[model samples]
Target: GARHGINMNGKLQRLQEQEERIFSSSCENLVEQIIEKKKKKKRKTIETDE
Candidate 1:
C-alpha cells in the first residue's frame, strides 16, 4: 500500500510539471501575439500619418 501511494504521488507530480510547461508555453505565445498586434497597429498609424 505504501508503495502504491508513492507511485501515485510521483505520477501526480509529473502531471503537474507537464501542465506547468504547457501553461508557460501558451503564455509565451499570447505575449508574442500581443506584440505582433502592437507592431501592426504602429505601422498603420505611421502609414496614416505619412
Candidate 2:
C-alpha cells in the first residue's frame, strides 16, 4: 500500500508538470496571435489615414 501511494504521488507530480507545460505554450500562442492582430490593426489605421 505504501509503495502504491508513492507511485501515485509521483504520477500526480508528473501530470502537474505536463499540465503546466501545456498551459504555458497555449498562453504563448495566444499572446503571439494578439500581437499579430494589433499589428494588422495599426497598419490598417495608417493606410486609412493616407
What clash count goes with each model?
0, 0
Query: Tens digits of per-residue lDDT for model 1 on 30-49?
Result: 99999999999999999999
lDDT comparing candidate 1 with the true structure = 1.00
- Please give, for residues 1-50, the per-residue lDDT of candidate 2 as tens digits: 99999999999999999999999999999999999999999999999999
Taking all chains together, each candidate's TM-score versus the true structure is 0.93, 0.88
Which residue pairs clash in candidate 1? none
- State candidate 2's TM-score: 0.88
Model 2 RMSD to the real structure? 0.9
Model 1 alpha-carbon miss at residue 11, Å: 0.3
Q: Scored by Cα lDDT, where does model 2 land? A: 1.00
